[model samples]
Target: MPRRLVKVFARLNPRRSPEDSLALRASVLASILTAELTILAMGYYGLITTVAVPLLTAAGFYISWRRRRERNLLIKLILAVMVVAAAVIFLRELAGSLYDTRLPLIRLFLWLQVMHSFDLPARRDLKFSLVSGLILITAGAVLSISMTYIAGLALFSAAAVAALIQFQLSEDSQRVDRVVAADPWRLAAGSFLVWLMLVSVAVPVMLVMPQSTQARLTSLPVSELTKIFSDFPSEVVNPYYREGGDPFDRPPQFSADSYYGFNPYMDLRSRGRLSDDIVLKVRSDRYDFYRGIVFDVYNGKGWEMSDEEGEDIVSSSPPFELPVDTSMPRGGTSIQSFYIQADLPNIIFSGWRPVSLFFPADRIKIDKYGSLRSPYQLTDDTVYSVVTEQPLTAGSYLRRFPRAGDPAAGPEYTALPDAYGADILEIEKLTRGLTGSYDNTYDKVLAVERYLKETYPYDLEIGPQRSERDAVAYFLFEEQAGYCEHFASAMAVMLRSVGIPARVVTGYTGGSLNPFTGLWEVRQSDAHAWVEVYFGSAGWVGFDPTPGFDMPGDASRDRDNFMLSGIIDYLGGIDFGPAGRAVSAAGAWLGRGAAWLTSVPLAQLSAVATGAAALAASAGLALRRLMLRRRQSRLATAGLSRELLRDPSLKGYLRLLKRLAGIGLARRPEETLRRFARRVSLSTGSADFEELNAIIEELRYSGRPRSDGDQRRVAALSLEIDERLREGRAATGRA
Candidate 1:
């Protein structure tokens, strides 16, 4: 009779039947649960969904794609398109933000997984999904330092376990599947063991891997030309001065008897100063300072060309020729070396004077005013080496003013501005104050230098100045403190007044060397200026009077604080101090405290203890099975079990009623006993829906969740829904 009722019910309803296979059931559960868990985990960590969702989706796609050959061609095509679209989006995003532009690639992985969910025709599809899960977890790790990666990994592990379970059961359905379900304790124990093994092995590999291993690392913007000057430019500043005066040489270039002396120029850049932190390393044993530009004269408002200027500097493609006037002494000196790493522009800095320089494959050109330059900017690190000539000191040439026809006078110095006469007198007073006795020009110059160094302090800040203040006079007498320009300019003006020619010079001072690469890391802040007093034979003598400051090659370089910065960054990794530490400790202590509290029977730990609780649960399930078997077994002996099992209608209705209760509106002891019957009798739905109501009333009101009569009703509903809803939707949509 129950079997007859089941057949009637099955005819009326469908989809009440169990899943076609164990793998399909497990896959559905794993995918849905993993998706939900990953979403929650990423959300809790405060990660943007663009990163999290795409990662999860990619995992799904990987699982789907792994079954390539067996998957339907149409489904594969759809998934492929999704993957490509995701990649495009990811690359486009990279152009916007420097952060997490890699997410779109993972998005493709997700769309493929969704497509894979449709047919799932073979075991390979299940395997593919598992692989995708693993890939997704890996992608998540790259995007953050958050613990959400750990959670995704855990979900992946769980899915793997479920996949394994399904695989094992599917092969021997009658044996393994039923046998495993036969004892819930054994199945749960097996799952625990598997989880433990997977996590233990995975931890070591994760920890030992190199963190910076990225597949595509070489993406830099193309090199572009960076111009230093766009006007009628000279490499060196202040290039013109009067005859009989050489500012680069120390001491007086002329005597009072001659009336010829250094003509002082008002430094134009004196106010617009340049600063930099550019670094260069000299790897050669013989120290050769890099030479840049040389200013040969001084003009009142800074120097410029007195006559025809030279050609524009050009960057060449390959071979280069030196532009030095060879008829003059071959002052060239060879220094060989290489650039370890440098990222400054092509403008290389060197020592005081140079005759020739070897250029790397790129063409290097010298402008009319003697500045060597290149067209391209160095965005990435570049390296090169060269040779240069060193200037001799003052112990050689006798003190004497230049003749009227001499070439060093460069015709530009014949005229002095009429307005400078008053300023020159003020300088004479300051220089006279520094000296009481007259000797050779060098000694007299040294006396003035000694006085200035001892009397004035150095400062870089520019504060309010008096309106009529002369820069040189104010610094030497009133302010007594200023940056490099002030000290250099003051000395130049004082020397010029006393008939001892001098000029101010500017360039970069050598920088601190990086020990790791032994390369000098020069920065913009090293810009410096000093007075180059004419010393006749020794060319120009470089001496600094910036109180307590030492020149390069004169002092020990101080080391940087890289180690401290590294330690600070490392300490920031996991929460440790005050608020973060307190939060962590409180969370940890809460777990222990809760565990301790729960040890008293009802809060956390099982009331009966692990062993006792397991036994109790086992007994409950066993008692239920026993009661079920006893009631059904007796009826089976009467030939009812086999007959009812074959009755699809009864089985369908019973399954429908059970599934309905799960959705909500579960049967309760307080529910009226006749309520279910009324629902079935007056049901306006299909016959199978009505039949399920009556059967549920019989079994559930009778205090059983299922029965032979109910089973038939469940079978009918299963057939009905399968045909009407599931199949119908697809057919109409496709049509």
Candidate 2:
């Protein structure tokens, strides 16, 4: 090793002494704990052996540390056992059928840390253990994509900083007269500040840095970790298997209930609370139902799709056009961009009639029903743009002019199962008057939609129940109060009964608009079912039968009351007693600022902001440097010792006392330090102040020159007092 490298290593590790070994061991253990948690977050569930081996090694090390008489023998035995176990595990992994090599390698590194832990009698071994722990954490980072990993990384960063600080303090104890330990609160605060700074710097650098255009290199075939688990048996080592084997050899069965809105087969009778979690964010000129799937075949039980294959469109390149009926007249086009925030199916959601798609994929498939699907599963990272036509506008020429029939739609749209026989007749009875009341198919469809919406009340508390008859029939005649599914089903069946080709379409209702991002936030609870009648020349026209649920295009009509626009209006109209004038003035100021911002080019504004941030950072750095220099000069003039200047023991204790006084626990003039400490400890249920009092007493009475150890003890006690004070303040705030 280079001399400089050796010096750096020696500085970090130091020579192991009895007094410092305990602190080193504690630091190493903390690092190990952090590494373990990070690995767990990375989805490594086979940590039984990984955890057990380290714990056992720690126990043995503890025993060796306490009993020096048999230390050498114990060390020898531990090493021998560790070597044999490691060899066995290595050979086992080599012979195993596991496809992913990363997991086994991580396991091996974890075991190596365990072995090193037992040999941490020396400072070098402890340093090695810390490095190994860091490596394990980095490995976990490579494998994880969960948001929880951010939390894990934060925790690991704090722990690592603490460990390194403790290690350096242990090293300094050997060279300095007294090494005062830092306050835990101050240390924690400092660590947090450093973490924040790192994040701030990293974010901009990441944005500006040149990103690799090359595809990611992987040891194994690309696959989702979740899919791998779902594909293979728990006991089986190999995940890939031959398709269409024996029923017993197939992958484990997943409950149909798990995929409620996304699945082809939807059982309306099955009732459960739908999650309110945001699934997608959509930016568009107008609000529209983000259509996902289309089920053409509705049996008596539920809805499903036909087995007919979709035509695959090459979408790997940009601006992939979807197959559309050129004969159908096109209306005004709407461009929409979607950002998925949850795990959905391969289906791509868009408005009623999507014309083209822009996505990063090799191929996408489109069915006759105009449902777009990707070749791969859609994840949170998936982003796509869609351009769609406003097919059925209220004042469209196509709506006024109707064509004969669509042979292209075939008999599938009008086909009804034998199970729907009685329900079809029941629907005919309900919509029988529609034929006489309306001339056009559009008016007849609207009549059925209006009838269902007016008759049935919207309710989501419908419990799960099995019906002897068709679900739609049960909803129409029996359960009059149900959600959108029931209303849409009834309308579709009723329209079809009157010879109008209609199908129940499943997607999300128009979502709540977020004015801040100018995006519509579609949640899982927004999953809806609606009716779509084939208007020969006008194309598929969406007709929502659910009461109070308007189509996305119509959603703009109520936008002022539905979103931030409503909030602004309400704020403007409200009388706030004495604050009304102030509120109005503030609102006016904000409005002016928004107008100014809108007038300026965004790129120019971004450049100005960037320049301002850079200038501020530079100014801050210069100011900090000047302050540090002034402080050094002042210390020099006072002729204060470096040890005393660096130590915060007295200042920290005074701050703690001041904090206590603020909390109505002022120290008496006559009360001794120990007595006051004991009183405070008893009252707060904390003994932290007692240690600080002990250090103060030692510093006051002892005649001997202060040692590095004494300084460290004092610093540590000060930190403890500060931490306790912080806790008390936090608790008071919460109360």
Clash totals for all models, in order? 76, 15
Tell me the TM-score of model 2. 0.45
Where does candidate 1 stray beyond 4 Å? Answer: 1-308, 311-348, 358-370, 375-384, 394-417, 432-438, 535-538, 550-735
* Predicted model with the maximum TM-score: 2
The reply for model 2, stretches above 4 Å from the true place, is 1-259, 395-401, 405-408, 555-735
lDDT of 1: 0.45
Residue-level lDDT of model 1, residues 1-735, one tens digit each, is: 977765665565332212235444464447444753553354322245535554554454344434433424445456557667766766685554232234445544554555555435555555666676666556555432233555666776776786676666664353310212335477657666777865765553332222220122211111112333444332222212233343323222322211111122224323322333234433332323343433434443343233223355343321234555443333335443334233443344555543434334334446443445543332333434444454433323324423233335223222333455665577788677775476556666667767767888766555534433555666665666777656656666666666665655555555433322233444345455555555533445555556655443331233122322222323334345687775665566655544344234432333334555466558768976887455433322222235444555555443443433322222333334355434432332334444544554455446555656556546656666435533433221110
Worst 10-residue lDDT window, candidate 1: 213-222
For candidate 2, write residues 1-735 as lDDT tens digits.
677764664465434444345755775677777776677644444558756855765775575456433235445555767778887887697444243467667777777766666555656666777787788778876555344666666777766776776677677455422223456687667667766776776554333322221113233212222211112111111112222443222332322222364665455665655767777777666767878777677676666667435776763345668878788877677777677777776677888788877665656677777888765556775666788887655744534645755544656677766856877787678788765666777667767777777888998887654456777888888888787877887777777667777787888876665432345677777888887877776777788889889765564343323222323433554457787876787778755654465455656756766886788689879987887555434422232235544556456555555566555354544467677678767766667778767766676667577678877776677667668667654332211
Quantify all predictions' global Cα lDDT against the true fold.
0.45, 0.63
Best by lDDT: 2
